[model samples]
Target chain A: MPYEKTLEELAARRAAALAMGSPKRLAERREAGILNARERLALLFDPGSFEEAGLLAQSVRPEMAGRTPADGVVSGFGRIDGRLAGANAADFTTYGSSSAETHGKKQGFVRAACEKNGLPLVYLNECAGGRIPDIMGAAGIGRAGEGGRYTRRRSSPVLAAVLGLTYGGGAFACINADLVVMRKGSVLAVSSQMTTSVAIGEEADPQDLGGWRLHSETTGFVDAVVDTDAEAIAWIKRALSYLPDHANAATPVQADHADGDAAALLDLVPETRAKTYDIRKAIAAIADAGSVLAIKDRFAKAAVTAFARIKGRAVGIVATNPMFKGGALDPDACDKIASFIVLCDSFNLPLVFLADTPGFLVGLESERRRLPGKIMNFMAALELASVPKIALVLRKSFGQAYLNMGAGRSDTTAAWAGAEISFMDPAVAVNIVYAVKREDDPARFEDLAKEVAKGTSAYDLAAPFMAHAVIDPRETRDYLARHLDIFSRRLTGAIGDHRLADWPPAF
Target chain B: MKRTTIASEITGKVWKIEAAAGSKLAEDDPIVILESMKMEIPVSAPIDCTVVEILVAEGDTVAEGQAVAVIEG
Candidate 1:
């Protein structure tokens, strides 16, 4: 009879804790079109798959007894698209999802569980920073679980979604995550605008403070922005589908591609070297249809970096957009490529460089941006990458940019018949060498330009074994598909070291 | 009716001015093109509006997030 009574008490306590927050508060959240913590979990995971772990953990602070349910954080293991994942959704209705001592400990446990079980960690953050009194003293200051510092273990992927106001611990987790997605109207920042305004002595509007526009275009903190929580969840599922469950596992592959005719590749790039076209068209032509997921697209216009598939196998793609600064490598573009290469190398994704760049941007503005340091950083990352590297010269590959874009010693090097590999543009070379203007000595200038361009032709370079093949522009998709398949099956002398697995996503 | 300012997303030279002041434009109509990173990014009207002012010339250098043109709906 005592055992039955104890079991009944346990069930009652669990039910009370799981109720989350006051009914009025829950109604307010719903009125604001925000999903409750439990509802977020339901949308994030497969039906009937969530097994919560901390329903009985009430806040240890005596005054807050029965006030904070699940310590304001509902954490557990669940099936995300049928694969196991560790997840936590901050219960904003409970004390504004403030960080209490028990909540921090639970989060640390959740992150560790994901690492130990070889599952991804997913965080749905809507926290309002730390609970003031709970974290005010020396004991509170020393607490380790308040932020995402426990996520240092890189054995599993950490993904975060900011659904509403996210400050302090919640902001730290999102910013530290490998990939972060945010809802349209959500705010993500180090501290709330109220606190920030008080500290900085300036009025701050929530709309302009760490908003979607700032993160997406200016800061690049968010990877994707969605209109609703459901779309954010869908994006998470899609991103997970491209990657393995853990860093140690193999990447997933899709077997079919139904993109339009591959022959359309010939029309994507212009015949005139000076004319600019969108390289995304060429990317679509070569990769499996609908498989190109671009990274940092809004940040660096000159470089097109994306994760794509060729014949179902995953690959990292880097291409120069000749339309932008003549496809030159600027400071921002250099950093973009370097970081992307590191990401692919960490995950064992083979790299494909579509070379159409003229060279590095040269000017006072470039110097001000510390182009030399950025160029060196990019070169180091490219040289250190251990994955199979392929370079395809579609039009122009000039000066040091040629080597940086995977020309020399890349596993496979190919060029279109019309491509040119040159030390610099012949026009620029002519201007530097000749004292007379083109109008004064038109014939001599034209002759000198032709002479400078002689050995730069793709056919000429291929004859000397500089390039492996000079292919027709239309055959690009077929050629890349064949080579990627060959490279994927190559014999490895040792397992991949995955050195960049711990690289900070934002830095 | 409300006024909207079209801003540049990057630091670049003004390559071309596509719309003149007082011209009526549909949503997404180009006002001016900024050349940066060797690419042309056309600053477009957010909604149906009339070009109220053109601030920068073709050769002018503009900083990121700078408003280069004004439009009134």
Candidate 2:
């Protein structure tokens, strides 16, 4: 039949591509429990959505003739989920997937496809680094940097995944991605552990060179991280799900859910103040169930950030946990919060702030982390976020943090509430006010502390209208829902152009 | 008097403007927030000044070099 010939021809071409880049060595990729180029493409793209290009591309060199799988790069057009997505799969099996003149051609190939087609672009990077022998000459490097290929190709969004050791070119591309998700235990850096160690005269672990810890926690590099191959795929899928197929269109499809009664939140907060509970519990009960996917769980344990749905609408949740270090905004916590704010604003996710900060961290350690700059940056992120924000002061908000958390200013507000906002902690205030008396008149200090604390309580701030409204802790669920409704439908708000994705993974 | 233009570093449309034309602003006054790379990068005034012009609309794809607003000091 005519169909049989077409199928047979397709198989021959695919087999040829795999073989070009030293098919035998592809086993190293398989050994790591990851899929090969074709398999990965198949898994990533929606069923029957891929239409590949340059299948039989090969090496130009005579000695390397008939070799180079898809010219060591899998460039193609595919639909990730019925929406167009263009991509490049660098073949690590050929010359370590190093960046070479020939390899650079394929890079341009995929980037051009995405730019021209108006589809989101991705790079499945698994490389050893820059091509060694070919990159030795100045002309080779010059040709490689021709025409500002990466910099000029900024019209479309680019995402990357690091599934194996990514150094040299691989690392650059991976880090430059708008959104990067890397497999746990994999390394990504400017140089490999051995190479950097040899150069620096130190014993280096690749994990130290670029581990999940280095990028995610210390430097705020990679955006989202996953533990398994499946999670990596799902993370990519989920990220793309929220974004439009291209920059020109609307956000992708998301299902709607009915708004629930505020009564369920009557028992959301614990009756006792001292007892601690998971903040995620309150978040899930209020937002669309099963849609609260929290990002950056390991870093900044004090504040929590996640993508969720409030009545099936995409929302960004930023909350504090008094259970952690009294919910003080430390440097780590500030960096974590500031980055999340940037991400949500970029993605058009409206914000829900659950404020419970006693104040920003004080003392020497907090200062060492450059807490002032971090706090200012956090405020800058908040000020820059033109998206709708509904701030609820859950328990305690004191000092300058009260204003920074949106208690003052009509900047971008939908609603505000539920807090005990004051100048300082009454206990600390009382000690300073009566420091000379505690030893001479111990009972007097106790009475004064209690009286001052009551005046600065949640009710006092509520009566004065410093906060929008002070409600029962139980009302936080419905209160947020009402404001979130008002924020997301705003057609008039300031939004900047796309730039953050290529910021290079932090570490 | 010196004037400066601050731009966003994200891939999002300009969503909101905190400063208005003719409004006096202090150093680091937030001018605009760009929604890009899944984050909001705010462009602010570098010094105390009065707003001269806002270059971006509510929803504009401003590149790194693209000015969101201009402030005259």
Best by TM-score: 1
User: DockQ for model 1?
Assistant: 0.27
Query: Mind giving the per-residue lDDT tens digits that candidate 2 earns over B1-73?
Result: 8887766532355767787899898986678765432223456677899999888887777753566787889
Candidate 2 local lDDT, A218-300, one digit each (tens): 56566677786667767877776655545444333256675544455546655433334456667777776677777776666
Docking quality of model 1: it rates as: acceptable
> Model 1, residue A152: what's the lDDT?
60
Error of 2 at A158 (Å): 3.9
lDDT for A131 (candidate 1): 87
Q: Against the hidden reference, what TM-scores do the models get?
A: 0.89, 0.76
Q: Against the true structure, candidate 2 has what lDDT?
A: 0.67
Clashing pairs in 1: A324-B37, A324-B38, A324-B39, A325-B37, A325-B38, A325-B39
DockQ of each: 0.27, 0.01
Give the alpha carbon lDDT tens digit for every residue of A1-507 in model 1: 769989999989988987898999999988888789899999989999999988888788898887888989999989988899999899988988888788888888888778887898899998899888888888777774445564464577778899989988889888777678889999998887899889998788875888888887667778788999888888787766666777667666676766534688777788887667788888988888888887767766689888888888778899998655568878888888887887777666788999998788777667888998988888888888777788999998888899999987578899999998888877667877775446678999889888888888998779888898899988888888888776665465212457766655565
Q: What is the two-chain DockQ of model 2?
A: 0.01
